[model samples]
Target: MVRLMPRKGERGNALLVLYSALIYLFLYLPIAVIILFAFDAKPIPGLPLNGLTTSWFAEALRDEKLVGSLLTSLRLAVISAALSTALALPAAMVLAWLPIRFKSLVMSMVLGPVVLPQLVLGLGLVILLRAAPDMVGEPAIILAHTTITSSYATLILYSRFLGFRRSYIEAAMNLGASEFTVFREIVLPLIRPALISVFMLAFTDAFGEFVVAWFVAGFTETLPITIWTSLRQVISPKVYALSSVIIIVTLLLSLVSQLWVIRQTRLTSKAPSA
Candidate 1:
């Protein structure tokens, strides 16, 4: 019997699958190495797998400096994400639903930080804050993170608002509801999932951020900055353990936020037809 050759479509699909596998391996190989090395018993994170052990995690947990830096990172991430969301929501609503002149220019300004290099933004912030040296610690880092993350929050919220049905607002208005009342009753609930997703995304970005934080942190050491400093001295097993924990936490947070965003999008799409 003659073996039938693969069709062209099947050949293309096989190539696509191979390409995808390669891409995933490229992206996750380092992460896999980090997780594997986190269990290495050796002080140095190197080959030969110095016998599997969990002591490095305990060492990382007990390191007072690492613990303090993790706490600082958490605080900064929460404050910055909340502030970014708070500032972006109203601006996004206005930009999406209201007619305004130079709207493209306004959006460009809001998104400028994303296009600009972090090193440049950090240096600029440092120069700007030099006038008031007192604001160089946690406040400066939070402000810098908020500036960067707010653009992302605004873009997400704007997309949600743009797709929003104006009929809801109009209906509430016809019933003698105030604008604030309409927003509180009709808008907030519908957009709550998007809001939460944006907040989580911002938190994830800020939590892992390092460059801008390094420049503006002054004496304050966030987890990323702490890790950077430690790496310069030595690639400790503790660092690997900490990185593994962070990787798990960040992946979980990002996955949940992305899933929530997708679910909210599906709900919104179905609502219009229903």
Candidate 2:
């Protein structure tokens, strides 16, 4: 048997592979640990597995506070996503297609929340909500979340509209279609994927938001606030279990969103020639 020496390019490729693997491991090892400890029979999450069990998951689901907070989060996320996307759709279209005076000023206001720190945004909302103390809980949370999510939603939809083929709209107008008719028949169908992507992204952002929600949540708790509260007391393995579920769901959502967007892009690209 003959031993072969690795070439210079082969050595570089091997190092690159090793480097990429290390990066991935660094990023994902903690998530893997959390997932593993979620199932560990140990009452507390830590190293050295005691035994494998699924009781934590059951316990997490059974915890009223956790379940309630999760439900609250879901409700807020859905409402925020829908409201933000609906608000963003028209704003995005106007920004992308129409020429208006003070465009820069208008855009700066629209995008202000995105660049502002969540801490500051929350504090500002707290001040604003002082006038109407009635809106300090779930309602306030929904408002704040929508405020943040709408900026992102607008950006996404604006980008989509910018890349849109104006020919379609023009063709509709040439055929004497009203603006509403054109939007209902032409633009909406074309941008359905983008709208869905914006909604999902907004939902995920609002669902995971902590600082803003914490400030406005008052007595009502969202999932992140609940998790933070739990951390201050005796940490529960159920938290880990719930977290693992969230992580898995988020990963699935992200993967699905990416694939859907890519497929839509490919279809849109082929539509013109077809």
Candidate 3:
């Protein structure tokens, strides 16, 4: 028996795989540690696991403040994600398919939040909300999250819209379908998966967000804010348990969105030639 030497391309591929594995290890090792420590019997999170126990999760679940914050975070994420997706859809369609003036300028404005630092954006929002002091808590947080997440949603939707088949719209119109009818029956159905993907992405981002939410929350306490405040003093194992749960949820959402995007892309590629 003999082993064959790898070709240059094979060698390059192996190196790429190794590099990707290292990157993933670096990213997920800490998360793995946190999840492991969440179940540790020890009060403090560290190496050399002291017995395994699910008590931390139960403790976390029993905390009224943590439960309330989780609920608030979920509510905020849902509202912001829905609002961002709704606002982005029409804007993305127009920007991707229509011949509008100052298209670049409009796009720049839409994507401005992505480029702006979160701290700067939060400060700006805080200053702007000074006029409406009543809007400080949940309102301000929702608005800020929507603004930031909408940029991402718009970018995702814009790409999806750009790849859309105009022939479908034209054929529907030729059959005497109104523009709105065409959009409702054809465009929406075709891009539904992309919409879901964008919505999920927005929700996950808003759920995990901290800086902007911190600045605008005022008296509101979302999950991230609660976690931050907890970290200011002694860290609790319950917080670790909560964080592990959040990490799992976020990963699941992201995985679903990515799979949806991949499926949508495949379907798009399989569309019949015009």
Candidate 4:
């Protein structure tokens, strides 16, 4: 009896190829559908490639309500992203700097919304706001978005902070730097990739959110809400077109941010050597 050591290299290559195909299919399948349906002249989605036309896109461009909703979505996303990042930066700092006893409890509390259904969170927020002075609008939407997205920001930033070389901050302090100054100068610059990643995640979550937005937003519609409303009335191909635009934009921004993070990490990894 003889035992042969497997050509571990071949197994690795096979696994890589399989994973690559799976990832590509997962990512591109929906995008392909969105693109195809976007150009489809027929309002109803089907096979046999209906005559290609730009009417859906043209209609999306001409739709003023859609435009308004998109603007609202953008504004909410930007505000939510900024507020979440601001809150997370400090919260993450605490989580990193202090050895908290209830770490799991704290992390779970922060990630409650992510684990819980958005519909449930929305319903709770709506009920809470009902007794107060009219609290449903852009403000309410932004507030709800911030609550959900801040947790993500905190997670991302905390990961970076936990992995960061604390000696840099310590060195800064040893060099007679103020605590705030050290954080601003050394800590911030080092963890910038995490900060940016969190900001983008917050923005994306806020922008794509439908449940929370629908529940909190009063009369002031966001893009997802608009799509929902339209979906009920008519399954407009323009909806697909609008979605395509959003998808493309999101993909572009995500790629850019990922590249930036990669570059920053590479720089950080090489800094000690330099």
Candidate number with greatest lDDT: 2
Higher-scoring candidate on lDDT, 1 or 2:
2
What is model 4's C-alpha RMSD?
3.4
How do the residues 1-274 of candidate 2 rate in per-residue lDDT, one tens digit apiece?
5759988999999999999999999999999988998998988777777689999999999999999999999999999999999999999999999998999899899999999999999999999999999999999999999999999899889999998889888888998999999999989988999998999999999999999999988999999999999889978999999999999998998898899888987887788631
lDDT of 1 by residue, 1-274 (tens): 7759988999999999999999999999999999999998887778888699999999999999999999999999999999999999999999998999999999999899998999999999999999989999999999999999999899999998998888888888999999899989989988999899889989989988999999999999999999999878978889899989989988887787788778876786677532
Evaluated at residue 274, the lDDT of candidate 3 is 61
- Given candidate 1, what's the lDDT at residue 179? 87
Each candidate structure's TM-score, on Cα atoms with residue i matched to residue i, is 0.95, 0.92, 0.93, 0.89
What is the Cα-based TM-score of model 3? 0.93
TM-score quality measure for candidate 2: 0.92
In model 4, how large is the Cα lDDT of residue 78?
98
Rank the models by TM-score, top first.
1, 3, 2, 4
The weakest ten consecutive residues by lDDT in model 2 span 265-274
Over 4 Å off in model 4, which ranges? 1-23, 43-45
lDDT digits (tens) for residues 19-119 of candidate 4:
99999999899888988888887878667776998878889889998888898899889999999999999898899879999999999998897888999
Best by TM-score: 1
